[model samples]
Target: MSQSKSLLANIGVQVVIAMIIGTAVGAFMGHSAAMFAPLGAIFINLIKMLVIPLVAVALISGAAGLGNSTNAGKVGFSTLAYFALTSALAVALALIMGEIFKPGVGIDVSSVEGMFSGEYASKGELPSFWATVTGMIPTNVFASLTNANILQILVFCLFFGLALSKQPKKNREPILQGVNTIVDAMVWMINCVMKIAPIGVFGLMAEAVGTFGFSALMVVFKLFLVFIAAILVFGFVIYPLLVQLFTKTSAKSFLVAMKKPQAVALSTASSMATLPVTMNTVENELGVRNATASFVLPLGATINMSGNAIYYGLVAVFFAQLFNIDLSMGAYVAIILTSTLGAVGQAGVPGPSFLVVAVLLAAGIPIEGLPLLFALDRIFDMIRTALNITGDAACAVIIDNIAIEASDLTESEVKQS
Candidate 1:
């Protein structure tokens, strides 16, 4: 009884069971399974309610704590570099896979003619670089907070935290202590919300399967298989290799430790929603310092979307192939660069992936067939989300080791002197 209870208590095991049952229900009940959607909505709403405050408090803690370290600048640079480079690598690999497999080669667009639409055409235009950059700055912090404008909130809190660190300890500790207290309260609420994760997973999976059904999937099943293959390569092969190369954490152990957060990411389909669980698992199970986990994971959840990179690259190639368009060398370069930047810009939220449109437009691919994918986006979103959080954890592991190595090198040099 005790052993069985433990298994049932494990969020990962419970989520897996819920997913299986939910898929079965959706397959059986078809559209009727959408009724279960309220469970997912309620759970997601509860998580969203906690997430804004959590991101606000946790990021402040991370920035302030790291600000006190001698290597704060190094950590910041390395974290951003890792996110950019890995995202580039992910998209490049996706392009290679798409080229080799050619999933869209024999696809018959005529059968799905009714589904195609040019309505999404206007959305394909990329926002100008200056506009995107300027948008990150906040005019009013309170208004940004109310609207859940994450980037602006991040900028303000990071600035506020770093500025706070420059103050005398007498002035800083009380506010820091109070913010830490709020973070603790937020974590407590996350734990409470997670207790119902199984129900949410069931509802979400049921609704996704029932709404999209398997018939539409036949048109894109090859794309699905290839996408999963690419995700597996990135998740298992690339991430594990990087961890073993840079950190003391064994590849197997890192993968094992990440199972809980990956499950949560899969069910919730939002990195922001999965942040608390990722922070907990990375710090406690994976033995990263709280400050490093706090710093890297949140930053990663916001910008490091390697999974989205892969999806965008593959979607561009899929559409190019579907139209029999012989993409130029310039088009490949455009696909890679646009996909990389687009992936980084993606908000850490659950929804249909619209970033693929920007990548397609960059390469001059048609946007009509995109509507076919919108229906299946939820399925793709769930799988890629699990991969996304895995990348976030991998960064925490590797960055923490970099800090450790830097400190040890400093100590050694001092002793030698």
Candidate 2:
């Protein structure tokens, strides 16, 4: 009885079980599997319901903790720079993998050519750099909170947290305590939502598999195969190597602790939805301090989309090959730059990403064939979202180590003096 209870208690085990059952149901139920979609939707909504408040209070607390320290600026810079560098690396890796694998070389697109559409053409237009910067700063934090404008919310929270930290101890202490209390409560609510995670995972899997069977993926089966390979290489190899090299946390421990959040990310396909689980794992299991986890993880979820970068880069190469277009050096440059930078601002949600359109267009690749992949986007999203959250944890781990080292150095210097 205790053993069974423990199995039931393990979120990873439960989610895996749920995914297997869901696949079976999807295979059996066919189109009727969509009935389970609301279960997944409700689960995602519940998580989203708590995300804004959690990010707000948590960032404030994290920033407040670091506000007086000189490491605050270093932490923020390192987080942003690390996200960009890793995303760029992800795109470069995808392009290399896509070129070597040539997943699109022998495909018969004429057969599914009817599925193509120009509907996504307009979405390819990315905002100007200045516009994107302006967009991040919220004029009204309340409105941004109401609308769930994540980028803006992230900016305000970080700024507010820093400002709050600068206040007098009497003023900051009670308020920081209150904010920290709210963060703890938010985590409690997140844990509550996770209790039903298995059911939600089952529903999401059932609907996705039922609606789009494994057969639909056969058209792009090679793409799927190569994409999975890229995910493994980056998630298993690159991120783990970085963790091992930079931090005291062993690669095995990092990967093992990440399994739960990774599974949640796979089932939900939303980094934002999985943020709570990521935080729980990074801090409690991985031993990252709250201040660092709070600051890095939230920002990473909001902006760090290395997973999307891989998807975008690989999809561009796939289509360019499918159409027999010889990409110029400039085209390759455009693809790498676009995928790397464009992924930075992507919303960490479950929807089919439109950023592929931008990458394709920037590289002068055809966009009409995009709809073919859209059908299987859910499967791809699940795979990549798991990678995305893993990258987030990885950044948290590395940055946490850097922060610790800097603190140690500062203390050592003071002692010497």
Task: Write down the worst ten-residue block by lDDT for model 2.
Answer: 340-349
Candidate 2 Cα lDDT to native: 0.92
lDDT of 1 at 139: 98
lDDT of each: 0.90, 0.92
Query: In candidate 2, residue 1 scores what lDDT?
Result: 100
Count of backbone clashes, every candidate in sequence:
0, 0
Candidate 2 steric clashes: 0
- Give me the runs in candidate 1 sitting further than 4 Å from their true place: 415-417
lDDT of 1 by residue, 18-117 (tens): 9989999999999999999999999899999999889988889889998988888999999999999999999999999999999889988788889889
Each candidate's TM vs. the true structure? Answer: 0.98, 0.98
* After superposition, candidate 2 runs with Cα above 4 Å error: 1-5
Model 2, 320-385: lDDT tens digits are: 999999888899889989988888678888898998888998999989998889889999999999
lDDT score, candidate 1, position 251: 97
